[model samples]
Target: MSVRMLSRFRAITHYMKLPDDYEDSQGLQFRKEDLNQREVNQIFGGAHLPAPMANKLLRILHGRRVAGTLNDPNLQVNTAQFSASDQRKALAYLRANIPVDEVINAGLRAEDELKLLEREEDGEQKPVETSPQDLPPDTATNEIPIPTGRLPRRRESDSPYGVSPLDRIRAHNIAKREAEEKRLEEERKKREEEEALGNIGTLQTQQEKPKKLSPMMQKMVERATSDLKEPPEMKAWERLLPQAIMTVLIFAGCAAYAIVYTPPKRSERLWPDIPPAAATCLALVGINLTVWVSWRLPPLWALLNRYFIVVAATPRPFQLIGAIFSHQNFSHAMLNMVGLWFFGTRLHDEIGRGNFLAIYFASGALGFMSSLARLVLTDGLIYTTLGASGAVYGVIAAFFWLHRYDEFKLLGYPPDPMSGPQGLAFIGLILGLHILPLFSKKAHNIDIPSHLGGILAGVVGADLVKKHMDERARVRAERLKTMGTLEGVVQVKEKGPEKAPQTAAGR
Candidate 1:
């Protein structure tokens, strides 16, 4: 036969559940002593099984006998001695079935063993009858009357001495239930007496007038009542005024310092000649840096980092612009500020405040997007890039376009101080910094592509601004010519003749 067919046959035959009439079967008739002896023999014989395993098998066999006897109390068969072969068969059957529910089977086994032991002890201490010679003459002549209703009968498997444990357990439960019922009944009677007293007390309270409050309490009650009146609701502006004032003060302070306070290079001057728009932008950067300092607190840092840093892995479009205003440390903030002061003032002078601001944001955005795209392609999600380096590079590009970078040294390096190659060399130097970290383990974080992206954006933006300046100027001049007082309405005729439409309504 095939292995599969053999397994199926074993599963059908040996795997059957305990028989329904197992209580009447001779297999479940073994005494506790016999089962224990067999278990000890198995362990001592150096059987190739764990001690606990043999013990568990014995317990399961005992439990099976107890579980079977649940319905048939009178079932009995001689089981004082078991053969080695029968013990082996019983152990195999237990191993197959008992593991299905070890806890429950073990419990049943223990309970049955305890009961059998108690029964055996009681049987051994059976009551002895006195002889006629030993008894008193009067006691010997008297006879004890037996109950007529029933006679005590012993089952084949019952103990030879005291009453069965099942009968004793039933009696104990009946006594306990009676005690609990009595306690509940007494409580009910006490509750009835209390309820009667409560009714009398309530009636007396209804007949009596309420006691007056003390003088001090009356005054306190009046004050409390008076204080409970609703206060007048605040206007929207009144409610928001403090927050608005604080915000304005913060921005105003930063702006005043940026405009009036001369930069380090022009420290000798009383005030720097910074334009209003550029000053405002610098002030906003200052506010962003102030918030950045509070980032030492983990929760705030996480919030700011997510909103401000250009996270290449989890890129958010808004962060592209916000990141240009963010700085990691004080040194980082100072370096960006120096860059801005050097190039920003010059760019503002050349293209006007509005155009400068537009180019600055556009270039920074393009630079962040470039870095984000490259990181995504490289699968560098954990990589992060921040600071205004992209915008600073954009300013540098604009400065180079308008003047010359030959005289200026970028980060203390200028290969050619007065040549066209200087600009290209400076760009190349920056790119080298970005690439150095990849090759050398000692080098720090550098985002070379962002600088290049900004420079390219700056060039394109500058060209566009220059091209549109004339058209923008002409439109501004026309708006000024049509300016009028708000109190007086002014109408103007079209310079060109109006053309009639070739439609049915015109006809």
Candidate 2:
């Protein structure tokens, strides 16, 4: 038999508490005593059993046995009378069967053998009789007498079995169920008590009213609230600096042109009849120059709306793009240009030049569309509005979208506690400020709808480009994987199997 089978057989015999003489059909006796350290090691190819198992097996072998049983076949008959050489041979066999350490450590002596025999004799001793009264009350009564009745008296707690086995089981089950229910009830009460305490604390806090703001604090709050309104006019130079520089440069260019190529006398127009492309180019230069001069010269703002204005008599699609480069005042142009410079440079770097231009133009177009839609919905006369505010607002939207996690402080707000989401919230608040006036008893002249339209356009454009790039990358990865698989298949086919030669006779 295999060593594993032998070990399993020994374990089964030990567990079943079978007699040593018990034999199978093959007459192979499983003597418990034979499952010693040496024999156990041999069964497992001399591998070391864990110390606990080895110790357990040792205890089992040493334990008392049934009386009058024959000597176990595993025990050597002349072990007690063995010579030195015989003992050495036996020890060697034992070591070879079991782990060397187990064989060396195992000290089986004549005294232990005699003790086993004595234990066996003691285990076989007959038990003395005891009185029923000496036992515990529960175990004392082996049976109960039934009362005489035509139908067995139906006791309250008894079933047909007289002892009411069902009643006992039912009582135990009911007790367990009641205990579980009680535990759940206790937990529920504890949670309710905690919640009640919390609510009481909150109520008490509310009852104790907060102190009113101090007179000084009240005054400060009033000042803060008033500060939100439009501020007083700036200095004369601060207002006209932007327009002054722009006017000087414009007249200088016009004068230079006139000097270089004087126009025919009696020309009806003071301005040259420039081509459409040159006109557009001149318009851009004028807009940029106006913005720059506005930053340096503030007084020229008064005449900007009258002199530098170009009104679109009929609303055209390109007017949206054109409007962004148009200005009503030096202040407006300067402010718009400042916004663009601050946000546009970084945005251009992030999305690249092509994408930036697309986003800017598309957002401005959307803003114009919003304005046109508003005009149609209101049935109001189409009014000319000009500024780079819509396009600049688009750049701001793109900035927020790309760097949503970047933090910045709102003007006149607490500094250290600021965050990106909070700054965006402030922007939303300002937009609401513009929108709320529409419902009030005031002229809602500002083009609030166009700003919102531009912001929405910018957000959508950036997201679309991002998603497109991601999809392109994913497609490229899938193509590479396919190519690799194809290459591997081709290589396998290229290295075809070599053929065996056939004999001449077979051929």
Candidate 3:
């Protein structure tokens, strides 16, 4: 027999020795000695057979031999009879001659040919298998079978892992490239949207515009377009009127106090000249009077100055509280009072009266310290800084930091165009007016440092408290998220009971 035939015979014998499930039992069963030449040809015939059947046939012919009597033409034979001893002899003959490598190569070749023929009969292209001959001379012979799914088969150049190492690296590079492209696309979209909103009427034609408005329409349009146009600032008198009336009433009350209970002066003042306790009592009295009469009076600038202003740098500590109620002018007093009214109302509502008062006084004390620090640092000599402006600026800062998202507009600026931060920025810009000594040349006359100090004190105080508020909000959000997840689980559990009735009815 040829080497190929001997290999085939050995493979069949080997396959038959596998577990029972892998064996085929069809056709003739033979013993070792009863088998003949006709049975051998029948087992190895050209008829197509499954792997199991072919293996069983080869096993039956394993060690059998051709009888000399069967070679004679006149001999009668029973086609089905084969002895176990004869089968063993044939198998032993084939195994003794066949090489193991030839057997493996032939089996693989046959499987490949069978697949190719099946595809061709079905009018499909046959896939080529990678072979030892196709590989480089130095390539290793031991290779694992590559996994293939619905995707097309790989070329010889492809790695056995289906994709080349370089291809995997290239794929990762492509993903990064795509992510960058998407980010740029989103940024471009945002810029386009902003540009479109900014040029609202650029695309509109002149004729498409509304005709000249009637008087009513003009007023409506004016109101609608007020945000687009800046308005004039309040005149000094208009701003100061509220403070001026309050001052007159305060002076009248002080004149009564002087007449009724002998007012003290530099020469006639009680011992310990401006006693600390007395000074504090007087300051509180003045503040109470200011608040009282200012409620009834139209403006209180003079009253504020009398109660709060202290000129000496080393003045009694009580003067700090006093200084917060003082004002330089009617405009100063009115502005401070206006700020207090606006911010105090909302803050008092949110934080409650007690906390509001605490914050207000704490803010005033901080502002006073800031002013004192500024004086100590900037000038060797102490100069008095006075004004409710510091305390009120603190209140405004607190409001802004606490309600940063709230929309606000300056008197001479657009409405809803500014948020709390923008409003604070506006205040800073106005304060800058006091610092422009080169341009305005009168910044030295104004206590710019005191104002800045008070603003900073207020910002710091408010920020400290606001942090606690923000943390509370964050904790609450997390709790709600966890609660929602638990609720979903409960709903799923409840659904089990609701489905049981339907399932039982169907059964």
Per-candidate count of clashing residue pairs (backbone under 3 Å): 0, 14, 28
Candidate 2 accuracy as lDDT: 0.49
lDDT of 1 by residue, 377-424 (tens): 675665788878788788777666554345456565545553334555
Q: Which model, 2 or 3, shows the larger TM-score?
A: 2
Best by TM-score: 1
Predicted candidate 3 versus true structure: per-residue lDDT over 198-284, tens digit per residue: 523344344345477778656644543324223234443442333334333433443343224423455664544754334433453
Worst 10 residues of 1 by lDDT: 145-154
- Which consecutive 10 residues in model 2 have the weakest lDDT in total? 145-154
lDDT, ranked from best to worst? 1, 2, 3
- TM for every model, in the order presented, reads 0.36, 0.34, 0.32
What C-alpha lDDT values do all the predictions have?
Answer: 0.55, 0.49, 0.49
- The TM-score, computed over Cα atoms with residue i paired to residue i, of candidate 1 is 0.36
lDDT of 1 at 109: 38
